[model samples]
Target: MTMSSGNGISFYMPRYDFTVRARWLERNARLIGVLKAAVPTQAIFSHVVVSGQTVGAVTRIRYDGPGVMVPRVFGSVFFYQPSQKINLCYGEITESATVNQFAEVIQEDLDALRDLGSKVWADTVANPVRHVVQVNIQEW
Candidate 1:
């Protein structure tokens, strides 16, 4: 399954069966949170960085669906390649550089989570909802 907003934001999954979606979210909660925080809406934040290092910007596009929420949050970094057109890769895929970059981003997000009086969970599912604040580290 693949979805796009035509602006910039894109989502893709190999299968449409979101029955295990919650499990998937739990596995990648930090990544999701970071991306969600990085890209709050249908706008692009350029020159994204954390602690003083540059990562990548977050881009939001047009979408008719209901607003994306934390619990219902569904954006992917591995399932699909971010693009204007909907493209389904059908499985988890990632590059070495992307992985390293994400590691840094997750670390930064984790620190922010702690500063906000939130517990860093070995399992993200345990993270409190109240502390799931959006990170504003965009250059634009």
Candidate 2:
């Protein structure tokens, strides 16, 4: 899913059963909170790095602003599941304006995330998979 409001944010996840999907969605939301808490004190044109780990997940967040001459601020959060050997989720927010827009972007992303969670749940509940086929090969 992608949202464009003067800035752009996109979210993606692989298809899975409803129960599994819901668990992942909740985990992703929690990671977003972790990222927000890790925001640097002086975000404007500053270099900051924050990392945190939660149960079954690890997040790496970074904020970079080379100098006052530069007006762009780039931040990213990478959430990984080592046991699964895959990246559970990822989010990136960029602000080109002079002022800090990270807060607004994060808020928008969170709202969108909630919407997505609801949509996925509703979709799965409304239309559930109904099929069963178990094949067993016997050697004689």
Candidate 3:
């Protein structure tokens, strides 16, 4: 799946049924192989604030060489209480990369997710989002 861009960020994040079919199994294999193959290249740190107070920074994301490799499927379901409508979506149809360059990718994706959380509305379902939590990437 090709990652979508928003709030000036772009990267793949999959959720829903397809996540059950393919991506779920693939990531685990790497949990054994690639994760061990890679070593902590560096420590991760960042400072975040919501409404003008310093929250925290650099939460200890161990940059192990590169991220894992795996296939993925993703989607999001949004419920808008005001509009009385539900938005069901699936996209970015592709397997993820190996040698993920994770230190960079994680920062990018987390930002995108946070941005999305801000823009959408809440309704019956909790605006649920789930994607392949890629532990490794090969840059395929």
Cα RMSD of all models vs. native, in order, equals 16.8, 18.1, 16.5
> lDDT per residue, candidate 2, 39-79, as tens digits?
32211011112221111111234334221222222222233
Reference-based lDDT, each prediction: 0.24, 0.26, 0.24
| Candidate with the greatest TM-score versus the true structure | 2
Task: Pick the winner on TM-score between candidates 1 and 3.
Answer: 1
How far does residue 50 in candidate 2 sit from its true spot (Å)? 27
- Which has the better TM-score: candidate 1, or candidate 2? 2
Candidate with top lDDT is 2
Candidate 2: clashing residue pairs, number: 0
Model 2 poorest ten-residue lDDT run:
131-140
The collision pairs in model 2 are: none
lDDT of 2: 0.26
Q: Which portions of model 3 miss their true places by more than 4 Å?
A: 1-60, 75-90, 94-140
Which pairs of residues clash in candidate 1, taking residues 3 or more apart in a chain or in different chains? Answer: 14-90
- Residue-wise lDDT of candidate 3 within 2-90, one digit each (tens)? 22221111222232111111111233333224322332222111111221111111212233333343232223222122322211123
